[model samples]
Target: MPDLRKEIINILDGKLLTPHFQPIVSLTHKKILGYEALIRGPSNSPLHSPFNLFTTAERFNLSTKLEFLCREITIQRYADLDIKEKLFINASPLVLLQPEFKKGETLRLLDQYGVNPRSVVIELTEHKPADNYEIMRASAKHYRGMGFEIALDDLGAGYSGLRLWAELLPEYVKIDKHFVHSLHNDPIKLNFVRSIQSMAVSLNCSVIAEGIETQEEFKAIEKIGITNAQGYYFARPTAVPVKEIDKALFAIEQDTDCKSAPFNNATTAVQIIRDITPISAKTTISDVMNLFHHNSELTILPLVDDNIASGIIFRDKFLTKLFSSRYGIDLHGKNPIKMFIENTPLCIDKNMPIDLVSKQLTSLMTNDPAFIITHNGEYMGVGTLLDLLAEFTRQQIDNAKHANPLTLLPGSVPINNQINQLLANKIPFGFGYFDLDNFKPFNDVYSYDAGDAIIKAVANTLIQYIPAESGRVGHIGGDDFIVIFTCDDWLTRCKNILKAFESTVPSHYSDKDINAGGIHTENRAGEKCFFPLISLSVGLVDPVSTSQCQSHVDIADLASEAKKMAKKIPGNSLFINQRMAAKNSGNFQSFTHSATKLHIVN
Candidate 1:
């Protein structure tokens, strides 16, 4: 035991660990979100994996020492790369507290590495429940107060991880690979992940899936609507992490966390706020002109009436009027600028959606100019027409570029974003998953082009039956579609979608098949069989009146279960899981989430 303890001390006292890094890619941004700092024991040693290294430390009573060494070396190497991205370092409270840290040595090392406290995320790293919640929470707050963020590591794999989440309220949570591994096909693992993701949304926590090693898993995670991912599928951990991921697989879109940037009622309001100070309405016209001349970048000088923006003074128009007659400034220079204060200022709520703002702009005069953004009837800032155009452009790029080429509907990227928004805001909605029964048979005989047309027809029908302003329609690749609807009449609308698609889609089939009832086609196993003409199977996932229906994964799964049930009915059918709305839940944690409580409809 003494010899083992000596070796543990030696490892911590010496350079026995190699610093490896892994890139955490943002699923929505298609960019490197950050690199997680991972430690490796010496090659060709029993301590190669971090698990073995830490376990040995725990056995040797040197866990704290080993943890410190890992953090020190990881921070120094991260600074060596001069990586500007956030660094996620694994740590536990016990590992961080020691006689040395009392002197703020960890913070000193961060300074030596030139790592910003803001950019350093200390992931509460452990596989078991924390021994002391008060101690761990205090440690988390201590680091947070120093501008470091707290992240829960290996969330689902840890005991009491949910309790830690509720108590600590970390900014990020990383799902353990055990749950993410082959999650594409594993219903149980998928359910675990979906529950974590849904609960994370309610807490305003960003979730990153770890150990994603396959494309199928990545696609599944995307479909579940998690915004961040880190695993070998993107890149294996390396000493020097690659800053630019040049692969198309990494081309994720930008993340819009609606928790902070809220858009109510599905409308996007682009908040155009500048940090510029304001001028009062009684300021002399001379003072206004001079202030404008001094700060050339100031486009709109707002006139405040008791802190509320009562009017605005346009920079260009103000200057033009001043020099219009050469002696104009002298004529009105000393006069209070009330004469120049706009009579009808352009003002819109800060929470208004961008599309709604665009419509409001179009209805006004063509020369309406810039509008002030107000919150609670008080001006917060000003927005120009250019800002509106830019926001629209960004949304277009996010939607049109990544959209499904066949159905011309939003593909997985936008679909995930929409789901994330709903989850972030805790908005209750219904998810309808539509699948064509016997679609492969039609595709085999009528050709892929005809199958594509059927998908389009279904997409159009879903869109036609569902309202534009209140729902999101998505194509989850071939033969599958997702719709998230937020109307009180969602159940009726879902029935209409099934009725419309099943009734109209039959015409797309050939006369021989239509009359014969089905076409002969080989199954996936190549066994010849009679495949019925295409029919719609719609699965509906209704949200509880409570926000307990947390994750898109649950809704997606419920929709899946519903769809599976519908498909069993032998024709175009709609199915609802009777127990879903009441039984399915994230109830602070999942053991309480039970399928037995679910109401299943035949």
Candidate 2:
């Protein structure tokens, strides 16, 4: 062990530690946001892992040297790689006390290597409390003043990180790996991270869920609105930052978790009042008053009697009663706040749906400043109507982004998203893949406006025929459409869609075409031909009938095969992949008019 310490120190002296870069993705933007610089000691050495290397250096009293060397190498290599994205460099708070740290060599090195200070975020890694909060604050402020951002690293796993958060107000706070691990299985961890996120938002800071190696954990974080993600789920740390995502990780849809919120109401209510501090009901008005005066941000206090919300008291009303009367404090300060609690304070059970709460909020009188949220008769927290409205607005924005602009129906993203959810839950449903036949020839002859009319008409038919409660329609660009049917009568409804499409499409054609049974047009390659009125080719895939379809991609591909089989038959066809299809009818002779007139469009 003693020999290992010297070996580690020698490794640092020779700069044997190189920075391995891990990419951080923005779950919201679905793009690479930045890279975190992780240092790795040389291979085949006891110091190969950063954990082992740093621990050995600390045992040898060379922790500062090792940490500084790590930072130096990270800055040098990251700049050399010309990574313009923000580079997060880890720095132990303990090292801030060193004299060399004060000389600003790191900033100079950044400049020397063409890395801008603005592009750097020094992650304050603390396994133990700093020697002095003032020194920590001052040191962090110094770098931040020079365009460097600060981040509190391994937040839940470290000592005094919450205090550091308050003292330094780091630009970003990365929830520890412990908090992120198995998050899908732990409600406590999810709530904890959510609380941290709410506080971080209030502080105007970002939350990065780090060490995310599983899809469940990644989705768990995104579902709660933490968008900045760094984890092996996205990319493993490599000597070179992942400039392009690998195929295995590619197309992993981000920001689709808004719909994954547990039972909507359950998840939404937890988000509200998540940051408010609860007080014991037995507490005196004097103590409550003191808390109110000291913490100006305090608005509503939930009086908890044995963890159950006995009542809620608003700050302004409580203070008003005390201050309005000169002897009010002397008379009642010693008494419990339960007596002063509002007679009609808006109390809501935490299990109530957010929409139900929103309705109650709108009906409540003005004096009810806050709503008391209780779980199993115990005080959970206090929520304002504002919080509920904000959540509502957020959901709306998320929904709008997934919708298709042309049809106002959900586009490809939502179609795939809903399919993923259904398959993940093993729900039986019908996926209808719709493509228009002769649409290209029709659009070519009639112009794009008429092409759009047919698309809109096809969309309208899908909407009208598909039962609203049991079906969702999606426009997957151009003339392609998708319908996910949750009802048992999906087959009948899909038949209705084809029937409606066939009957209505002829109306879009000119009087001459209607009499002619379709229009005459020249398709690509400049060949003159007679094309039938626009008809739909629907590929119906009963995913549950066969072994479950693997993914949305598989679902689409299978449906496409069925659709190709359908289009081979001519006008208005329904091809179900795992069953019978409409094909080889006499309409084929009328549809082709001439084989030279044909073209395929999906």
Candidate 3:
């Protein structure tokens, strides 16, 4: 014990703490959101492990001093390295309330190190139960008042996770590593995370999934719609963490997964972002009043903390309350704007579908009719309900015009629009052409009504099986459909659709034909032959680079050729086009129409 105390003292006096950084990445944007500043003792010391170092310090009643040293070192090193993203520094509640903890000590350190308070998130770590909620709340607010965001770290591992969350209302909550490890295979764990995500959404906060160490775990989190994540899967803690995401990881995210599946050409909140400058929560209310007086057109004031949209202040509401009492302005004008800010204001991610945003706005009973727009939980701009309605209505009218009357799915025109958009954006995606086999014979036997049902069934299967965020389904008339898949597991989705179609087709057939395994029908040559039951054939074209294909026309030609290949098979089949690969290998040229048209307009 004496030896440990001496080592601790020497370490503190010598300032020998090493600050290592681990990246916190955004799965949605495929970029580094920030880094958590983790402290380590000397490599050869017995107190090398953070847990042992901190526990021994606590045992010797030097916790506050040690924690302060860690903070100073972290802030200084973070600025020295010139990292651009936010820096998360862990702060225990006990250290925060200690008598020796100076009121402006952290602020002084930040200013000395040239680190912006807005780029730092004070991650509250509960080394033990924190029974004093009021003091903890006050401490958290102090940091928040300085433009720093608060985050509850290792949520489930703490003794009073929900209580602390409710008391402090942190801007971010990190799900404990225990809940995220092997999350893909554990249904209960997944459910816990989903519930946490749902709660965060409702509370207008962000959830960061921690300790994701495997690809399957990340895929599961992506599917669950969690945006920010931290784990070894991305990178481990080091003196100098990776500044840019790995290209392979970026490709995996882009080609296979989306936190929120946005259809090709889908309108998102970003389209309606109004260029509005946000105010820091620490801005004086009098300053806000002066601005409102100067700009009559401005109606809403967005409150941002550490780049996160924390709340909003309505121009009219704030003014009315201030003057409702004679001494209101005199009493509250000097107070920070956050004291009167609307904590529950609507905040929408920029990538959210406009239709969904419209739905959210309409469901709310608030009369302000405004929302703050964010990108990966960072403030981007503000949007109003009026603009959202206009955009959503435009989309609806446009979709209705190009929709197939039979299936109400996107028809040829919209299909072309989607394809053109994908090509223009240079987004990598698989294209699948769907066609029904033995359809003409089925129409002959069952009539147009039954044939329509069959076509609708195929459309339903495609829509049901394909994930909406990564794939878009379209009807190209009759039994022909098209699916554009940005998800990596497109082949699996296609096979599932085939299996579903096979299961349902038998019910559409009579028992005698079912027993016969087919129907004896007249062939195109007028000869009687056995026609098998209607089956689906899917031809998939792997993601082709924009350099290889000029437009949707080129893709259509390649996919159509693949569809023909699939049709030649005996039964339901999926044929993947490898022309792109073969062409790259110098075995084949680019696929194009066989004959050129000679214009003969009369």
Top lDDT: which candidate number?
A: 3
Cα deviation of 534 in candidate 3 (Å)?
2.4
Better of 1 and 2 by TM-score: 1
Worst 10 residues of 3 by lDDT: 592-601
lDDT of 3 by residue, 121-217 (tens): 9998674765577666876988898889999999899788888887788989999999999988998998898888877865657789899898888
**Candidate number with the higher lDDT (1 or 3):** 3
Cα displacement (angstroms), candidate 3, residue 329, comes to 1.1
Report how far off residue 40 is in candidate 3 (Å).
5.4
Q: Which residues of candidate 3, in runs, are more than 4 Å off?
A: 1-42, 49-265, 275-284, 290-297, 303-311, 320-327, 335-339, 342-353, 356-368, 373-381, 520-530, 545-547, 574-602
**For each candidate, how many residue pairs have backbone atoms clashing (under 3 Å)?**
15, 2, 2
On lDDT, who's better, 2 or 3?
3
| Candidate 1 local distance difference test against the native | 0.73
What lDDT score goes with residue 208 in model 2?
Answer: 91
